[model samples]
Each structure stands twice: as structure tokens, then as C-alpha cells.
Target: MVKSKSIYSCVECGGRVLKWQGQCPHCHLWNTLVEAVAEKNSTRFNYTNEISRVQNIEKIKIGEEPRYSTGIAELDRVLGGGLVDGGVILLGGDPGIGKSTLLLQALCYSSCDRAVLYVSGEESASQIALRAKRLSLATKKVHLLTEIQLDRIQEVLGKEKPNVAVIDSIQTIYSESLQSAPGSVAQVRECAAQLTRIAKASGICIILVGHVTKEGTLAGPRVLEHMVDTVLYFEGDAQSSFRLIRAIKNRFGAVNELGVFAMTEKGLREVSNPSALFLSHHEEKVPGSCVMVTQEGTRPLLVEVQALVDKSQALNPRRLSVGLENNRLAMLLAVLHRHVGIACFDQDVFVNAVGGVRITEPGADLAVLLAIVSSLKNKPLPIKIITFGEIGLAGEVRPVQRGQERLKEAAKLGFVQAIIPKANKPKHSVFGIEIILVDRLEDAVTAIF
Candidate 1:
């Protein structure tokens, strides 16, 4: 007869411990230890062994055929043109972030050349079908399956011979052989590993939807993220109707690609011109406002930057920033004081990127700095002015990449002037904006003032 055993696992790292402790030595997180039913000395059925019989590195060959597109241009762009065969992609986001909706839409509108299977452990076929109907996807080829047992899922995969498969979420699916409950680290890791092997052996593209922690990272163990070929994160304000899907890791394509979608009554609509949605058309020019062109992956977008500086009565002035790095804001403020003689120490500074879009590129540094300075000076920047260039510690304005695309986007959006790096030589004379080249931070301030 087999004997049952008990074990404690660190919730953060999934490391096994004989007993519970106040803090986990493996993950350093406090009070995250949970008692789990440990499996006795046992070995479950190995799927990789079956795969090894057929799939060796020497047996694989490269093909020239392109990846399969899902018929959504924005999604295709974020996925580097299309979904790669045998790729395992993990999609994560906060609850109600539309992770499942996006994949459901993709599966419904996907090119009908391949057999597609939609597996859901969280929702019923009728629920998913209703969503598909609202999304205007009334296709017959897309098969739906609702199951949680990993063995059953594998059995279906073997019989269905699907070219593409999607698991609604990873946390809900459990391997029956695992003694631990669903969403346990062991179950998540084991399931992800099996799915990855199946995907590679069958030449099927597998998309796994995953839940997110409160900190907004993919839930499950960190190993779950490492097991996949790509990690895509869906981000946006829950209260708002806009969402951004970004690829943070891709083995076959470039990272940092972004896809913009607006959730509506019908379904998610791709934002073809995102810049228009980011900028506000105000007849009267306002102080503490500026425009900047930022690049995400290969695309350039123009957005508005706003700042407010107010005299503080507290002993320590507060510095608050939204959609921009707070530490970077502090560093820029210090540089402004040291080089440009702007004393913001007695004032409370607040910086925000309009439209809730986060900007991480250093090219936006000059625009953010200028916006703060303009607000402190109570001066309004030119209405049609747009600027973007990296700011160095030495008060130098460094050149940004893809300057031509930035300028072109600004021009298309009715911007009349641009303060860019002096090193960028325009390919030809363009007329919409007067391009003012500046090589230093003070020069940018002067140009704007």
C-alpha cells in the first residue's frame, strides 16, 4: 500500500520545505508558505518520451513559408506579423483586461486553412459563443472544448489534430495526477511544461491565457513565464475602454511591439491611428502642456505631456508622476536645477502622460523636462510644437532613433514645429513643421521658451 505524505511549499518560489517558517529562504517573501499534499514516490506518464522518438534536432528542417496571420492587423503587428508554428505564447493581464476576448476574436477570425481548437476551463461553450457572436465571428471551423483535466485535454489534442490551440487560462487547468489543488505552483509548472512539449512536437501554435498578480505580473511561478516562446501582456485602465497588448518576450520576433484596441459595445476595435486618440484638440493653448513623439518598437506615436508645479506648504515637497518613471523625473529635476537654474525644490511637481499611455523611451525626456519647466515658469508652449530627444546628464540633447518616422507622424497630426536632435539630417525638405535642431538641454529650453 502507498503512504500519503505532507509538505509545505513556498507560495512565491514553489520550493519545498519540511515545515513552515515566518519567511521563505528561497523567495524571501514573508508568510507565503502553504501546506500542500505531497505526492509519494511516483512517476506520471511522460509525454516528452513519446515526442523524443520522433522529434530530434537533426530531423527538423527550416521552411520559407511565413507565419499564419489571425486576420487582425494590430494583433499581427504585435506578434511580429503572425503566430509562429509550434510557438507557446502566454497572455497575461489583470482580471477583465480582455485577454480571453482578444484570443477568442483571433480564433474566430483566424484564417480557416488550419484546424483550431479553443479550450476553456473557466467558461462554457455557450458563453464563449455569445462573445463570438457579439464580435461578429460566426464561424463553424473553430471548435470549442471546456475541460480542466490535463489528460483529457491531451486526449482531445491527439484526436482533434488541431493546428492551433488556446487554453483560456493556465491556473484553472489541473493535472489529475497532481495531488495539489488547481493554481498551485506544481500544477501550473507541470501543465505548462506538458503543453510546451505537445506544441513543439505537433507543430501547433498554443496560446495560454494566464492570470496576473496584484503587482500586475503573470501569476504562477516565474518558471511558467520562462517555459513559453513569447509573453504578451494586456494593459489598460479597467475603467476605460482602451487596452494595449504588448509583447514583452519573443523568441522569433522583436520585443516591445504594441497593439492598441478600443473595447466597444460590439467588440474590440483596433486603433489604426493611435496618435489621434492621445492628443486633445484644444482651441486655447494651456500652460504646463507640451507634445512629444515617442517610439514603441518600430512605430512612432505622438502624445501630449502635462505637468503642474504648485508651491508646497509641507516641509517636504511631493513629486508625483503618472505614466512616467518617478525616478527619472527626479533625476531630470536635479539636472534642471544644476544646469538650467530652475529651483523646483519648494514646489510640488506632478507629471502625467495624457491618455493613460505609459512612455518609457528616453526620447521623451526633453519633452517632460520642458513641460515641467514651462509649468513652473507659467508659460505656455507653442500650440503646434512637438519635440523628442534624449537628455544626457551633461545637459546634452542626444539624438533619438527613427527620427524620420517621428517627424512624419507629427506632421500628419497637424504639428507645425519640432525640436529634434541636431544630428538627425532630414532625408528631404518637409514643409508641415519647422524643424528646429538642438544639441543641448538649455538649447531645447531656449527653443521652447
Candidate 2:
């Protein structure tokens, strides 16, 4: 019988320890030291001895080139075209955020003639089948397997030799060889490394689904994301139906590309022009609301900025912002007070980037600050005006990236006036709309108000 050796491991960073303590000195996580047993292995492979018997380095040769498209436009866009041959891609998102649904929908549309394996460790075959039925996908060549054992998954891949394989989640799959439990840092790291090797060796495109942490980062150690060839993050409001898939790391394609999708009663549907969905239809112009053009990755997006300012209730006024950073809003408010003398310290300020889109770019600085100004003054911005420019601490509107794209998106959305940074040169005059270039925030206020 093999004796079990006890070893302490940190739960947070997966660092091995000799003994347990009240606090983990490595990851700073309390009560994370747990003793795990591993079967003693007396025999080990001697790779150095084998290398001594081997010959010299041989000539390098090129390998096979084969890739397939999932037929989803938004997914393809984020992937920089399609899945690469022998690529390991990881897709991570919040629970119940339609990550599984989106993957199943994509697989359903793909490979009617080629064999594609869909493995799920969390759900049963019946559950996936019901979702497939709802998606109305004819899965002729698509195969579904519900298992968690790493050996079984490897066996299926070796036997079936599918063109593409998707693991519903990597956290749930565990190897009996590893003493650590599923979803643990050790298991997650080891399992991902094995899958990457398998995909590269067999020339298979494997897409692994991952769960996200509360901090909106991919769950598991940071190393799991680094192990894969491409890392795609599914982002959007849980309350809203719209979903955005963004590529954070892509070895084969563009890194910052994004794909937009909408959840329907049937399944996830791709939105070609996300600008239209974000724009609200209002017959009359509302006070404290204005339109702005912003860029997400390479694509330009047109969104609305709304602000509401009211009397303060307590000693400290409420500063609420949704889809926009709260600290940035407070900073902008301070800038308005100090430079422009807007006197917003005593009032309750609420600012939001409409359509559930989060705007972090300095390009939206002018739009958001102006919306607050418009709200405090009870003034309505011109119906035709749309603004895009970064606002400085000294009340200057700075230039934004891709000026032409922002102008084109605004013009396509029927905005007739634009107050942009004077530093940015437009490629050509846009037809119909009046472009008002401003150097300072005060100039923008004068042009709009």
C-alpha cells in the first residue's frame, strides 16, 4: 500500500506550505491553509538520462493549417475572423449570464457535416438538449457528453477526434491523479495546462468556459488565462438582455475586439448595429440629457448621457452613477466646481450612461460634465447636438481617438450637430450636420447652450 503524505496548501494562491497557520502569509487569506494528502510515488521518469541517449537537434518543419468558423458574426468578429487550428480559447462570464447558451447556440449553427463534441460538467444531457431545442438547432453532427472526469474527456477526444470541442466549464473538471478537488486552484491550473497540450498536439480547437469572480475577473488563478491562446470575456448587465463578448487576450487575432448579442425568449441573438438598440426614441428633447459618441475597442458607439441633480438630504450629498465610474464622476464634479464654478457640492448628483453601456474613456468627459451642467441649470441641450471630447482639469476639451469614427456613428444616428475637440482633424466634412470644434469646455458650453 502506498502511504499518503500530508502537505499544507494555500487556498487562495495555491502555494504549498509546510504547516497551517492563522493567516496565509502568501496570499493574505485567513484560514486558507488546508492539509491535503498525496499518494507517495517512489518511481519517477528520468528525462535527463533519456536526453543523454538522444541525437542532435533536427531540422524545423512547418505544421498543419486548419481552422473552422462558428458562423456567428459577433463571435467571429471578437475572434478576429474564426477559430484557429489547435488553438485553446477560454470564455469566462458570470453565472446565469448566458455563456453556456451562447456557446451552445454557436455550436448548433456550426458543423452539420463535421463532428463537434460539446462536453458539460455542470448540466445533464437533457438540459443541454432542451436548450438546443429552444435554439432550434439541428444537431446532426454535434455530439453532447456530460462528464467531469479528465480521463473520460481525453478518451472521448482520442476516439471521436472531433473537429472542435467545447468544455462548458473548466473549474468542474478534475483528474483523479490530482489530489486537489475540482475548482481548486491546483486542479484548475493543472487541468487547463493538460487541455492546452492536448489541443496543440491533436490540432483541435478547444473552447473552455470559465466562471468569473465577484471582482469581474476570470475565476481561478491568473495563470489559467495565460495558459490559453485566447481569452474572451462575456460582459453586460445581468438585468438587461444585451450581452457583450470581448477578447482580452488573443494570440491569433485582435486583442480588444468586441461582439454584441441580445438574449431573446428563444436564445442569444446577435445585434448587427448595437447603436440602434442603445438609442432611445423620444419625441421631445429632455433636459439634462445629451448624446455622445464613444469607442469600444475599434468600433465606435453612440450612447446617451443623462444626469439628475437635486437638493442634498444629509451632510454628505449623494453621488450616484450607473454604467460609469463613480470616482470619475466625483472628480469631474470637483473640476466643474473649481474651474467652471458650477457649485455642485451641495446638490445630490446622479449620472448615468444610458443603454447599460459603461463608458470609461476621457472622450465622454465633456458629455457627462455637460449633462450635469445642463441638469443643474434645468436647460435642455440642442436636439441636434452630440458631443465627444476629453475634459481637462482646467476646463479644456481635449482630443479623442478615432475622430472620424465617432463623427460617422453620430451622423448615422441622425445627430445634426457635433462639439468635438478642435485638435482632432476630421477626414472630410460630414454632410448635413454642423461640426463645431471647441478647444475648451467653456467653448463647448457656449456652443451648445
Candidate 3:
């Protein structure tokens, strides 16, 4: 018989210790270590006499993997042409961020006619049924189970080997073999490893809904992220109906891909034209409003970067921004002051990406700096102008990647002119829009005003 021993493990880093301590010695996080039982070393599978030894990579058979489409084009794009058979996908989001609703809708409209099982530990069967009815998805061939026992779930999976399984949350599932409770670091890691093994062995695609910490990350061991095939995050403001699904990691596809969606009473609707959604309409040209093209994966998105520079009332002027980084804003401000000779020391500056769309790429640097200058100078930029390029600390305009694609996208949206880095100037213009090349930030600002 195998014996069991007790040990404390850190939830933040998975570091284990012999005795209890207030703070983790490795991760230094306070109160994150939880006591868990460690079963004695025992091998579950023996393959000494079997033919399943290490094989040559060249000799291994390669077959085309099947893809299960969720019936959402945007999601399919993010997942790199739908879900692969036996893939483990980890979806994380804040409470009420529409994770469950999206998965339910996916199950309802799956293009693949395979059987699907959705296991939820947080909601009862009746509650799930009500939600399905509300979404008008009562007739979809999706099964529901509200069990949290990991052992029982595995047993059911063995009995009913569905092609796809959706675990509403991995944190709530616990193994009876473990003395620790659900959501503990030890249990969460072990459960995920076991489920992933099952997925590979049975060719069962599993999507695990994961709860996030207060810092907006998965609420279990950090290793949970490394164990999954893909990691997706749902991001959007609560006040706004617009939600963005972004892929941070993918074993089958490109990373940093984005899927735009709109939250509705019926369910989440995919936004076909995300550029139109992020750009606000105006009757006349206004100061501090500038259009910039950013690349989210292979897609080119045009969004308005708005800025407001006002006389300061306090000693230390207020610097506020939405959908933009504060440190980057400060750095841009410093560049404008030191290189461009634009004095904003006493002025309060506020910058935002229109429509609550976050812009992380530095390609928006030129547009943002121009927006601040336009607002400070009280001059509006030409309505037909589109600007994009990275800005260096030395006030030089830096060329961004996919310059031609960005220009074509802007021109497709009816822009007549573009201000880009000198390095990005086309040998021969592909679009009808006139290209304005600038090597330094001062040159672009001069051309604009």
C-alpha cells in the first residue's frame, strides 16, 4: 500500500516546504502556501515489455488533425481555424465578463456534429437550462453536468467519451485522493495535468474555464498556464458592451491575435467591422483627434487617438489616459518637451483611444504625440490624414512593420493622405493616398501644422 505525507506548497510559484511559514520563501507572497498531501511515489503505467517505446520522429506516422469549428468566425480566427482535436484551451476572465455565455453559444452553433459535454461546478443543471433557454439554445445537442468531483468526471468521460468537453472551471474540480480542497494550488495543478493526459490519450478536446485573480490572472498555480495548449483572455470595460478576446499563447496558431465581440441580451455577437466600431464619427475635424493604424496579429485596425491638454490648476499637473499606458504617456511628453520644444510642464494632459479600445502597440506613438501637439496648439489635423509609426526617445520617427498593409487599410477607409516614417515610404505607392515621409518628429509636426 502507498503511504501519504503532508507538505505546504506555494500557490504563486508551486514551491514546496517542509513546515508552515507566513510567506513563501521563493515567491515571497504572503499567505499563498496551502497544506496538501503528497502521495508516495508510485508508477501508474508500466511499459517495460510493451512496444510503446521511444520511436524515431521520421518513422512516426503523421495524419491531418481534425478541427472542430465553434461556428464563430472571429473565434475561429483567434483559435487558428477552430479547435484541434485533443487540444486543451484555458479561458480566463473576470466575473461576469461573458466567458460562460460565449462557450454556451459556441456549443449551440458548433459546426462539427460531434457530441459535447459541459461540466459546470458553479451552476446547477436547472440554472444552466434557464440560461440555455434565454439564449434560445435549448435545442442544441449539448449535454450538461454539474459535478465537481474530478474522479467522477474522469469516470463519466471513460464511460461516455465525448469528442469535446467544457469544464466550466478547473479550480472548482477536486480529486478525492487529495486531502486539500478545490482551488488549492496542489489540487488545481494535479487535476489539470490529469485532464490534459486524458485529452492526449483519448483525443478529447477540453476547454477549461478558469477564474482570475484580483490582478486579472489565472487564480491557481502559474504553471497552470504553461500546461495548457492555448491561453485566451476576455477584456472589456463593464460599462461598455464591447468585449475583446485576445490569444496570448497558442500551440497551433499565431499569438497576439484578437477577436472583437459585442455583448447583447441574446448572447455575444461577433463584430464584423472592428475598425468602424473603434473609430468615432465626427461632422467636422477636431483638434486632438488623430487616426492611427495598429496591427492585432494579421489584422490592421484603425483607431482614433484623442488627447486633451489644458492649463493646470494644481502644482503637479494631472496626467490621465485611457486605453494607453501612463508611463508611455509620460515618456512621450518628455520627448515632446526635450526634442520638439513643446512646453507642457504646466498643462494637464489626457489621452485616450476612442471607443474604449486599448492600444498596446508602439505604432500609435506618432499619432498620440501628434494628438497632444494638435491639442496644445489648438489646431485640427486634416480630416483625410492617417498617421502611424513608432516614436523614438530622440524624437525620431521609427518605421513600423507591415507598413504597406497599414497604408492599404487606411486608404480603403477613404483616407487621402498618410504621414509615416521615411523608411516606410513606398518605392511606388500602391494606394491612391499621397504619402508624406518624415524622418524626425519635428518634421511631421511641422508638416501637420
Report the number of the highest-TM-score candidate.
3
**In model 3, which residue pairs have backbone atoms overlapping below 3 Å?**
none
Is candidate 1 or 3 superior in TM-score? 3
Give each model a TM-score.
Answer: 0.92, 0.89, 0.93
Q: What is the lDDT of residue 405 in candidate 3?
A: 92
Q: lDDT tens string, model 2, 1-449? A: 96657777665676777677878788888876767764345432223222334445575455644556788888988887887878999999989999999888778777765568999999999998888887788877789999999889988998999878999899999977777789877678778887887887788789999999888888777778878999999988878999989989988777878789999998888998988766667798778897888888788888889999998988999999988888888888887887766788789999888788878787888989889889988988888788888878888888988998888888887888888899975979987788898888777777766
Off by over 4 Å in 2: 1-14, 20-67
Order of models, best lDDT first? 3, 1, 2
Superior candidate under TM-score, 2 versus 3: 3
lDDT digits (tens) for residues 18-88 of candidate 1: 88888888888897777777876577646554433457787799676469888789988988889888899
Superior candidate under lDDT, 2 versus 3:
3
lDDT of each: 0.87, 0.83, 0.89
Please give the distance, in angstroms, between residue 113's alpha carbon in candidate 1 and its true position after superposition. 2.6
Show pairs that collide, candidate 2: none
Model 1 residue 297 distance off true place after TM-score fit, in angstroms: 1.1
